[model samples]
Target chain A: MSTFIQTLHLAWQNTNSLLCVGLDPEPTKFPGALANRSDAIFDFCRKIVDATAPFACAFKPQIAYFAAHRAEDQLEQLIAHIHLKHPALPVILDAKRGDIGSTAEQYAREAFERYRADAVTVNPYMGFDSLEPYLEHKDKGVIVLCRTSNPGGSDLQFLDVGGRPLYQTVAQRAAEKWNTNGQLGLVVGATFPKEIELVRSLVGDMPLLIPGIGAQGGDVEATVRAGRTAAGTGMLINSSRAIIYAGNGDDYADAAALAAQKTRDGINAYR
Target chain B: MSTFIQTLHLAWQNTNSLLCVGLDPEPTKFPGALANRSDAIFDFCRKIVDATAPFACAFKPQIAYFAAHRAEDQLEQLIAHIHLKHPALPVILDAKRGDIGSTAEQYAREAFERYRADAVTVNPYMGFDSLEPYLEHKDKGVIVLCRTSNPGGSDLQFLDVGGRPLYQTVAQRAAEKWNTNGQLGLVVGATFPKEIELVRSLVGDMPLLIPGIGAQGGDVEATVRAGRTAAGTGMLINSSRAIIYAGNGDDYADAAALAAQKTRDGINAYR
Candidate 1:
């Protein structure tokens, strides 16, 4: 199998898309049959995946969203379906997991083995050892949270560390010291395109997972302009609620597909 | 219903035990019948909890250990068992989960509603919003990771932010601003007694969940002296593998109980 980043590059070329469809399934937000709690998270995500697969470069399913509803089994099925049908598209398990050494190993297994994700998002607060276990997975991608999309992200991330922001230090570390496997990426929020640009300067050509674009009101042009590499690639622009819940009706999948296309085109215009 | 801190205080008083028995089950490390795969995580942890209950002020089940083995159902069952048998002892689910606002809500549901954990450990990397959801749980404890037990914790926790270390800054925030609910606590690793002392001084009698003491080689006396409040309470000294896996034979539960009692008495001496 090609490496996770390689597979992502392949998807970018084949589909000509940088859109990473975030599958954050809220049971209450589902339309029609999927909402009644019978046909569940798996069904809704499967439908959205099938509808938007061609237009998306990656799929990031936030683990909390699955684990909250105890829909992990369904999440497993959803990833299995994605691998079977949309093999080229990488699935990033957005589980910002951080812990000590041995515990970190289990979290890595949960992401790579239990769920069989191509990539996983991790929190950098615990430092290198917390991330070392995840990086040991040869072909999988380990994306570190640098500048998060939330407004409260600044609460700690912007603390000055040696005249540079903490997020910049994280980006520098992830780019320089932590990318031992060469299968690493950094999460720079779409809302903070300037920080994204700063991270881009720090980590040359490393993949950036950009969240907070569509529903969170991040500027698409600024995100693309700030994060994209020389090849006009290297960014996964994520839109979750905006795309997946575009319509609260029976044609939700169709609406999701349209939204995914619009998002993909919007990023491409800036590229 | 008593608040999470009140319940923890009650447990400490009733048991006269500062020890928190951490049930981190690695199936491979199981002894005899439990190791054969016929008996599962719940069975292993249930036995350990039953044996160590008298000596432990609380029980902390690390989520990664269960989720790694596709044992979420067992985790749910185990927490239910803890509530059923040891109603007085609080169960702190050590998940170390962190995310943005909306997703954090789902995680809060998982910890408080699905698993019914009395308290949960959270990573503070994403800042206040990531924690707001967990804080919303009326009587459940929200324990933020300050200075972790792992050596790698120094990677970011010790970064200089305005002449003070990052972890002290975290402790200040958790105590001053984030404890909107009376149920807030901080995870100050037993390994860092100096930092723990600093944290205690910052957040006056707030409960500090102290991990890394037993298997990780943290000094019990130092941990107890540094973390305890004026009333000789306000700490949950967690020992996971050191207590739970004290034996490799069928009498593992008996050995775990022995270890738990010894650990409890050791802390009581310091108090």
Candidate 2:
């Protein structure tokens, strides 16, 4: 019932972890009995959640992965399963949606009311009003995309807006103006440790959902060194394929649990 | 089965109209017997499509509206209905999705394969690779956001990236580099007639999906003048709330048809 930040802080303290296990269920890569069945999307993710919850501070399910397979029912089931089984950990639906004010309200409803996620990732390309509807949900977390993990993210994100880069401007605006309800966070890719440092300095201990570790080849030590707050706890470092698709056999769940634990400990070492 | 451009040209010639009827179904705005049924999303959209098909070159269903009401099933049915009834008119899924390459593939599958849309809108903020998956669908259309109509869109869109603005950079790249398969277009809001003119000059006859008409109060005369190609058929001028919600009684469908015909003829006059 607490706000997303409070829930995240509690999860971090209780689990002693900062790792956010990402559920990007691609059926082509799914193993064993779970390969092509639409129902297995939920079955596979539920097992991973059961296995990895001990080591994660949060769970982020990328909406595109489920919607691609026409398994939105399964996505709903998975989020409900997480809330029921793992009550402490917040679920951040990685949708990255943006639109004008009227349509953005619908997207906000889909994420918070339908899918029941504690937080949702959104794109900032449409600017202030596009994000206002999500921010109106005072208790839910609204994380804005700053610097992305992919190489092409530099296309517009790194453009010089005024003096600093566009992503820096995004971080500054998100922290100063958009955080009216204290529910805003920034998605800073771990690959760009320097940008992470810059965003961290600009936001001042606000939550940063750092992707691009593990499978994306980001240096974790450098990421933690740059992104961590003075108190050493202001990020949800996400690992998707590197953890969930870590193995291809029946033992995939165990492999995922092991991967999650190692990554959690790896993040903890610097913190 | 012709390419998207060929199909669009055919539709433009056959319909003799530039209006694109936008389906943004808000249940709260529904009338009479279909006020709150989840099935009404499809029913209302189907009725609107039937009434407006004679006056439209295309139909655009904004995905957020359906997802907000847990009506993705209805969205699928509505598209199928459009194809069955009005085969000449292309359906553009206005999703505005952007992500990394691998994830973008999932989103591309969702829009093109699952939804069976002739085209889909995308955000260009992530640059080349994020859009590559969608562009890879050689036969389908890929429309990228350039200068949006919303005032908040100016926040990052108008920032000077190089010599001009970020949107111009987007238009140039979309035309020169990303139009490899001849499946590229840009979204320039109808509200900004000058920017539409600028984008039209930059992209040189590539299709422009112009929204922000009708309820958004965009000047149709200026929009058509600024966006029309030398051939006088290169734009899909979209009108959402103003046409669909023209009446709230059981006569809503008749009112919508009247509005669609008026708008279509008005646009024709300018073209």
Candidate 3:
């Protein structure tokens, strides 16, 4: 079995579900009870982790939200807390880092070594050289941007490179050429279910990180249908704001847990 | 005049030189005197800025080094100091940030609205939408990664796409299509002089941020030859480590000043 399949098996056993809770703690959107305090962000994340740890397979923290508030240290602390508290739960640093050569090496060191994330999201514009550094961490996964679940993602990703859209070519290249370490995955945004199907076909058995199911208007049923690999082996459905900030009061953690359970139920129902 | 031409004129008038000192203050490379302290990084950068201000048209700070040590706050303080001390010196934030749509807008806000940099480097992988936010700042320049200086850059950049290398196509697109706001420039690494010349031909008059000149073994004369536009515009030759860490003692500032002067002299002699 591929490393991705083994990760899925572990995720399934740990959470009894494939729900990936997104830890995108935007400061402005923080609950009134925790506003104006940086530590509140950590508090909020820790509580969510505690509440949903039993129901979620992995935790994906969007780096941009933390970076915007100069909360890198807070993020590091949160990741450490996740590892220490729930050692089996994988931490995917959603940094979307892509650069060339030595700079790429530095980023790999920053994300995997210093930050100690189990996986990282990378943009494939600079091509394979950028991905190589991340793949060197054989035990960790390198998720490449295939067909993103955003409004403007189609603008460039769907551009006709030859007879087909660029993203299709990217998916094929990633599956055939770039998976030397068998640690490759593609981020197929949940919003674009049709593109998800196309990417699924191209990438074959590679794991798919299907984001945008909650706040981004992606149909959960269609995403599950389109993103599933052979025999449904590789799909990580991610929901950030929908799960974390499901409610704004003292019941936030319960609300998050309920949201996560609902997403898992939705996926299972479709299956 | 294009923003590129205007910047060239500004450089010639203010510093009487085409040199840019890159403040890539890696914490690991710092002398034993000021090791592992955020304040020390700022102090070191301040000294370099003060000493090199007269000889350099601008200062470029690689955000990675600061971020590596979790010294972004220190970097912000140092940049604020540079603005106050040398108001005429343009500060370029070498951040190489790119994302899809709304996320890119947030990044633009962080780099331009918050950091207040005169210019910020960006990647073109996610296409025009990722860059749209940066272009909204009419006066600030956006340096797009065209053909990088690293040895592994050519792995994908030189791939044949419609009978031209991908980088050349990017240059053409930037010049003809993406420069709608006239705020676009290209980062052509000094190490790849021939490719730099090719990109120059395609870009016509777009300003180029030429990195990899000093410690990266790029020939100063050859870089200038390939980068300068027909009107003697474009080209900002950046030297980071050689200028910033010229000495390790209290007299490091003086050594940095001398180094800056020498680099400027080299460019002028070549011109």
Candidate 4:
């Protein structure tokens, strides 16, 4: 196993949970302590990291929230702060980037070399060539979008490809073909429990980052049951908005930690 | 006509050229004059905008380059500078962002509302609903990825969808169903001149953003000939690295302007 997998396994063992607290700090939903401050996003993320570092196996930072703001330095500070607060907890940058060959290589450098993210979310629309650069980082994880947890995700993902849904083909290819470096993972949305079950079956032992849990209204019990691997080890249940914005007052961090614990307990209930 | 279309038409009349310079400034490719400096990107873009503003009909900034750095401020500055320098020049934010409803709405706000781009590129993988938010801005152009200009683009794009290649189906859908607001355009790679011809036939009057021109080794002459609408008003030939990095020295801007002129002349040769 690669360093990322080892780190992930170690995290699970240490936390006694498979929960990944998604650090998607939306500006409007920031706590009162940080509401009108210039460093609101950074402060909120720092507190969340400090509060939930013991419970979360990993932290997934959605790139869109940071990208939406003009204060990019704050994003870098947030990542740096996370690393300082929880040195061992893996930071997955949920950017969902995809592009052609050389351009993709530059993006890989930006994400891994510049930001030092342990892993990243990628869109596979441009095919395997776009993913080759990320795969070169033997220690980093490349999570490809499989069956997303959204209403329109079925539009193209469910399109017939050789008498099977395109997502199934993506899953099989990711498991057999794309995981050559042993650093592959799939972003399976928890909203579609049946699809999650199908993908879990298709991709035997690969790690799965299952999002869409809380805010998206995914059935936690059904998703956890459907997403577990045969070894019962390769799953990361992500809860973003629901946990981050659990409270809008000064006790937001405590509320976030409690919300994260509840999600972890919910997943454990299914397990 | 929409604001984007009107801007392009006016730009064509003013410059007497149909060239659209693609501003994709990779940090690694920055000259020694601006080595490892973030501010260099803004300076590079401003110079290019000033040098080629009078020669080109529009400017296409590939969002991936700016997004790679997650430099939202730089992108905003770049767009603002372009509008300030060349007030009537349409800025197409080449960001192939496509997601489910709410997420798509956020992306639309980022590209159109926050950045205030005249046009934006989008992926059609998630289908109509993902693109609806973009199309709602009827005065701004929404360029859908139809037939990309990359080698592996055919892997999924050419897949048989209901007994037809997916690109053809995408073209048909864009032309018939998705073009309700008349704010649609297609991204047809310049490398595939034949596919360009086919897509042009499908999307009769809609504008086409043709990339893969200079550095990607696309045949500019054939692309312009096969991709242009019958009225000769539908193609936006984009050449990124070749024009921007035409010379690696202090004379880069002048060389880029000359390179833009050459690309424009090359496209006009076939026209």
The candidate that wins on DockQ is 1
Winner on lDDT between 1 and 3 is 1
- Candidate with the larger DockQ of 3 and 4: 4
Give each model a TM-score. 0.98, 0.98, 0.89, 0.94
Worst 10 residues of 2 chain A by lDDT: A29-38
Name the runs in model 3 displaced over 4 angstroms.
Answer: A1-8, B1-9, B36-38, B245-252
Candidate 3 has which clashing residue pairs, if any? none
**Model 1 segments beyond 4 Å from truth?**
B37-39
TM-score rank order: 1, 2, 4, 3
DockQ (model 1, Cα): 0.91
lDDT of 1 by residue, A163-223 (tens): 9899999988888898887888989899988889999999999999999998999999999
Model 1, span B1-271: residue lDDT tens = 2288889999888999999999889988887676656447889999999999989999999999999998989999999999999999999999999999899999999999999999999999899999999888888999999999888899999999999999999999988998887888999888889889999999999999999888899999999999999999999999998999899899999999999999999999999
The positional error of residue B8 in candidate 1, measured at the CA in angstroms, is 0.5
What's the DockQ of model 2? 0.82
lDDT of 2 by residue, A48-154 (tens): 99999999999999999999988999999999999999999999999999899999999999999999999999998889999999988889999999999899998
Worst 10 residues of 3 chain A by lDDT: A1-10
Please give the range of 10 consecutive residues that has the lowest summed lDDT in model 1 chain B.
B31-40
Docking level for model 1: high
Candidate 3, TM-score vs. the true structure?
0.89
User: Best candidate per TM-score, number?
Assistant: 1
TM-scores of chain A in all candidate models: 0.98, 0.98, 0.95, 0.96
